[model samples]
Target chain A: GAGVSQSPRYKVAKRGQDVALRCDPISGHVSLFWYQQALGQGPEFLTYFQNEAQLDKSGLPSDRFFAERPEGSVSTLKIQRTQQEDSAVYLCASSLSPPHMYMNTEAFFGQGTRLTVV
Target chain B: SQQGEEDPQALSIQEGENATMNCSYKTSINNLQWYRQNSGRGLVHLILIRSNEREKHSGRLRVTLDTSKKSSSLLITASRAADTASYFCATDVEAYKYIFGTGTRLKVLA
Candidate 1:
């Protein structure tokens, strides 16, 4: 598919466990973003990557949340010692141009990975 | 910490009626975008309005931005059942970062 792709559409894990989610952004995209959406709520920004560099992670709720986009293509979000509050749909999106450009291009989104903590 | 907040958390309207949802932000923004999300699905971009632009339209979707009030409104004309979904407003304050509103759950009854 030409759009962004996310791995493991659904995941279930016990509390205090660890999990990793993967995202494959559109080829040649310069900016990628990760968002978390709780049940019946809007998607909240989690982190952003401009190529291999993590530009911003201010939205990350805690240090337990980590994300990396090594080599500037595929990205991974890892949650260490996942808590019930960490359970939500993780969405990956990519835009063709860098955010600073201030272009009107829209970002493409993936199906997202839903994580459930028991 | 959310920058944008939407009004009428939930709205119900008959199909063919126009639906309007409003969003307000706390700070200055470069651009504001609207997105739709179906149940259990990722968000799909609907429209983007820059701070300098007051209005934009895409097919049946119309967006108006009031920078003076730090607000924006999305109007969907001739709504359909397929339009039933959650609508959110996101403000782009900086590069690659978007602060989203709580969202408005719109239910278009057929």
Candidate 2:
């Protein structure tokens, strides 16, 4: 794909079940970020990976949330023991630069995965 | 954690009218960007204004950053029904990490 791609546009998980969301960033992009957005609220930063290195994971809400980008291409966000509060839209964005290093640093985003915990 | 706080949580205006939204942040930012999100969709980058820069314009969108007040505002001129969406400000505090504001929902009636 030419742009960021995310799979499972819609996912409904039973409470306590585990769910994994996938993201494929733009090819050759140096930065990838994950965010969680609740109903009527803005996105909250979750984790960030500069290529294959996970530099920041401070925004992960809990130990149950795990994200990885092993080869620095594809990324995955996994939630263990899904709860109602975990139900939200998971967004993935890819930028061409690594932080504040570029003149034009706007990020390209995927349609996002809308997760529902029932 | 969220850094920017947008004002006028919701706004309504007629088509062809101008709409404005504001955002305030707490920390120093390397750059500030605006994004638009329609209902049930991901965010779309609108504009990016560097800290050293004061204002920027892209099409009908005009963005201003007042670093002294730690605030930014987005103005949409000649808004259309298609322009109805939620606008959010994302502040780049350090690296690729961006903290987004609560957003302002704009409704353009035709």
Measured by DockQ, the strongest candidate is 2
Worst ten in a row by lDDT for model 2 chain B: B90-99
Worst 10 residues of 1 chain A by lDDT: A97-106
In the predicted model 1, the residue pairs found to clash are: none
> For all the predictions, what are the DockQ values?
0.75, 0.80
Indicate the DockQ of the complex predicted as candidate 2: 0.80
List the TM values for chain B, per candidate.
0.98, 0.97
Question: TM-score for every candidate vs. truth?
Answer: 0.97, 0.97
Number of the top lDDT candidate: 2
* lDDT (tens digit, per residue) of candidate 2 on B6-25: 98999999999999999999
Clashing pairs in 2: A99-B95
Q: What is the CA-based DockQ of model 1?
A: 0.75
